[model samples]
Target: MNRTNLCIRMLQLLKARGKMNTTQLADALEVNPRNIREFKKELVLAGYNVEEVKGRYGGYILNDQYDLPVTIFSDEEKDALVQSYKFMRTQKDFKPLTLYCDAMDKIIATSKISSNASLHYMSNSIELDKKISSMIDKTQQAMNHGICVVLSYQSLKDETPIEFEVEPYEIIHYHKSYYLIGFSLLRKDYRMYRFSSERMFKCDISTRHFIHDNHFHLSNYIGEHSLIPLDLKHVIVRVYHKENGLRLFKEKYWGNKLLPIHKEDDYTDFEFYTDDMSNLYQSLFSMMDQVKLLSPDDVRETYLNRVEKIINAYKG
Candidate 1:
């Protein structure tokens, strides 16, 4: 009901109906003549191209066409979407914001879910830490300001659990777990610690705050690096087929980088790189005849050694 909003809404009315006079605009907006005149000038300044007549029957009109779309979101629904994805039930993914937006289009289109609408599912599809999600959300804000995190943690080497101060660098979700990537004061190095395993977590004053990078976004961190053990190298295996698989790759990976390297009706090579070759190794064993380790000799040997161990076990 704000006068400014009403004035803006008047354009939508005029776009629907051919034109509207200053009197009608005033009546619609429930404002005075001076207000309507001011609104008209404001609209003109906003590139509305307004025209007006001076006579008694004279009225204001739009000199140009309006093509912009008018869209609205219900307050409750917007709140729900924000709540669902903001934290706890957060939709924070390893995908970049740009990539996330692209994925959101696909997610909304395929899932038939509204972008700003609340998510309510009959069947549970997501599993994670609710409290930890909230904490992580806070951690992101704190990371921007170079704050420290004090969380209850248990180490495998230690018999009892302890709370320690650590600088929150990033949060990476992988293999059904949420890990906080950061430099620990006690450990004095970059460490990946589990959030769910923590009994309690909060910021401590004794610890130092350090902003790692403006582009030190956690989503990209997860997408680029996550779920792999230390000292593992990423080996991208590209597979090319004559047809069909490129579309599948685009659909699955949702990127042009992998798809452009392969073409339709041409031999398409499938390429993916991984240091933790356990999954790839097993896959290689199954596709022994079709799949080839096109990259490093060591990568191929790692697969061979696993097969050798299996053969040795079978013989023994």
Candidate 2:
């Protein structure tokens, strides 16, 4: 290892093992015992808290409070990190956007000397409106501080905005949109609100502080295949162009409960247990003639009706 890497490894060893004598550190780092003192000086000069112990069991110890910034990265790891940053950049209204960019800039600056690889990434994430972005920021701040917020929200069913107090718990991203999960003071229960800039007229952070409910867990409300708390259904579909359909499902619904129940030479019968039927319908519609809803008679009827409406519209 180079001198720079050796110094870093020594600090890491000290941090992990608590304390290490010169000989022990040298053995661990595969360096000479004499170089240990030099490495300690280098770390101290770089603002790391490396302390020396004088007793028989003593050696060098990194202060427990101070954490060393991880600067080491392989070429592949650096490329992957850069690509992640690029992808995040595509989400123009991502909360904590500035913090992520600043952190990535620091990492890139440190890794520039080791590798100079260029990478590109593309994403189709929706760009959030400015008002919605501001609301998300406010909600995040409230969640961090354990505070209440007054939200003027208007759901699709509500003709006018309904002002209510909420104990903000968590904000989650799903399907290129943001949702707030919190305790609604009006309903006196947990609720999930999909953010809409046009409908959400006000999101004012209140002065009242709140203690987070210890019994409340996100998993209790949201299932593995759900965007919000809802009952999941067993759905089966027959998809033509087996190769293409399989690839699409694997790419889009990799984590969901998807399995192949049957297959033919040209088509495949895929089963999915999902709570997000809207997303499912949208994805199936995108596949056009290559997909068919086979089971759950009501859902199949709904899909057929939607297809018929589209067909009729086209005929007009």
Candidate 3:
């Protein structure tokens, strides 16, 4: 890490973990023991009250009463913050817009980068519905307070609306949709439910509270679920330059998994991996004339059948 980040991290360690000896701080920051003393000096210079205690058991601690100084940001970091503020400004349902704008202005003022120069990029993310926004706020509050919520959910597979209690663990945003990942009392297992007004009729936070499982890691849980799987299916495709296949690869249309296996004058064989075959097939179909599925007979047959059905529909 850079000197600025290192100093900030040292202060964070002291504030979060309380008193720590130089050796402990050095080990945590992966720096020399002498460097911890230097970091403490830098923090003190930056208007932080870092006090050292005397004795064998004593160590350095931050004065909890003192307020933190305005954090200085690098030019690149300032640009990123400016761009994020611009993106959030476009979100109609963002409730804390005023506070965020004020905070961004103050942060940018302290940096060398001009906020006006960084306004070149705008996000095309879908705006959240007002109902969904309200749902997210309530769910966040319930999760913060460790309370259970009664959700009236209408599953697509079933028309009847079912009421169930869920212990909200995390709210996930994927593919322009919000999902609540929680423990379902009805199923007695973890479940992921979409947060849409069409699907979720109601969500009421109950007075009942439950102890949050400290061992529940969101990444570990998502890995076990199919929403974000760890196992990826390998895919191979022969791409011709005729239909902008090479341009798609250049633009990283296949995400981070696109790789070249073999190259020829007229065509190239590329390999990639994905957990979502449906999305992959859609992408391939969009460029069907320029790409051919070479391996994985089952997947190839499925793709061919879907194409055939589409052709038959057009013929009819």
- Please list the Cα RMSD from the true structure of every candidate, rounded to 1 decimal place: 18.1, 16.4, 14.5
**Which parts of model 2 have CA positions greater than 4 angstroms off?**
1-126, 241-257, 312-316
Worst 10 residues of 3 by lDDT: 115-124
Clashing pairs in 3: none
Please identify which of the two predictions, 1 or 2, would achieve the higher TM-score against the true structure.
2
Please give the RMSD of candidate 3 to the true structure: 14.5
Residue-level lDDT tens digits of model 3 in 1-316: 9889999998899899999998999999998898987887777668786776544576788864612346777767776886675556444336775666656654544453454442122123468888888887788778767789899998898678999999887776656677887888788777888889889988889776754543343444443213454456678999898767788756545533678899998899988876566566878887768888887787889999999999999997
> Per-residue lDDT for 1-316 in model 1, tens only?
8767876787776776755677787777777866876776678668675555433455666546333333354666555543444232222333355554444333333342333232222223456566766776666666555578776777677666777887776555555556677767677656777766353444333345442322222332332222434334535454444245334444443111332334345545544444345555655565444444555677778777777888999997
What is the full ranking by TM-score, best candidate first?
3, 2, 1
lDDT of 2 by residue, 66-107 (tens): 222557777777768855764564443367766665566556
Where is model 2 poorest over a 10-residue stretch in terms of lDDT? 114-123
Q: What's the TM for model 1?
A: 0.37
Estimate every model's Cα lDDT from 0 to 1: 0.53, 0.72, 0.72
- Assess every candidate by TM-score: 0.37, 0.55, 0.57
